[model samples]
Target: MTAKAHADAILNLLRTAPGTPLTVLDGSVPNGTVAPYVLVYFADEDPELPDSRPLDGQSQRYVVRAYVHSVAGNGAMARAVGDRVRSALLDAVPTVAGRVCWPIRREEGRPPERDESTGTVVMDRVDVYRLESVPA
Candidate 1:
C-alpha cells in the first residue's frame, strides 16, 4: 500500500475507536500475481484503567496494521521495500506526540521477519505509541 493509504488506515482505526489501545499483530507482502493487494486494517481498545472507580469511564487507543505485497516471495529489493515501510510508520508516530496526554508511549510499528533456514531475522524499523494518538 502507498504511504497515504497506510496513514488513512491508521486514522480510520483511531477514529472508529475514539479512545482505546490497539495492537498490530503482524504485517507482510502477499505473494501472488493478482491485485491481491490487501490492507490489513485493525483496531484494539484498551479496557485497562488506572483505577476501578465508578466515575472512571476510561480512554482507549485505536491501532491499525497495513500490508503490501510484491510478486517476489522474499528478496533483497523486497526487504528494502519493507524497511522503508517500517521507517515510514516509525516516523509517522512522533507527529502525534504531546498533543493528547503527557508522559505517553510512542506508537510502535516494526518490521520483523525471520528465516529459520538461516536463523536470520530482520526488523527494519520500530515505533512505539505515546498517548493513544494518531500522528496529527
Candidate 2:
C-alpha cells in the first residue's frame, strides 16, 4: 500500500475505535482551533535488505506518528488518549484497500508534555510496520 493508504487505514482504525474521546485528524489541526484531538500522519519509509529465501517479499519500514493533544492542559488525558491509540495499533495488521497489511508493530511512544506556545498537553507515539508490498 502507498503511504497515503497506510495513513488512511490508521486514521480510520482510530476514528472507529470504541470510547476514544478526541477527534482524529489526517495530518494537522486547523489554525486557531484548540480542541482535544489526535493527528495521524505518515512520517517516513525505508527499504529493508532483501532476504535470500524465496517468497521473501519486499519489506519496508514505515513510520506512522500519532500526536495527541488536549486543551484542558491535563497531561493525564493526553496520556490516556495516547494509551488508547497504542492499544488499538500495537500488533495490528489492518487491511488497507482490500489487501492485508501484515506485521505491523508499535516501535516507541513518548509521554505527555506541555506545549509551551499553545499551553496544551501533547503526547507523541511512533509505530513501525513491515509492509510486505513492494515499495513504489
lDDT of 1 by residue, 1-136 (tens): 2233334544443334322222222344344322212234333444444552234454433333333321112445445443433333433433333233223233444443433442433322333432234223
Candidate 2 C-alpha lDDT tens digits along 1-102: 466777777777777777845577766778865545676556655445455223655444344444333233466766666667766666666666644455
Q: What value does the lDDT take at residue 4 in candidate 1?
A: 38
Q: What does each candidate score in C-alpha RMSD? A: 10.6, 4.3
Task: Count clashing residue pairs in model 2.
Answer: 0
Model 2 Cα displacement at 34 (Å)? Answer: 2.9
- The TM-score that candidate 2 achieves is 0.69
| TM-score for each predicted model, relative to the true structure | 0.37, 0.69
lDDT of each: 0.35, 0.57
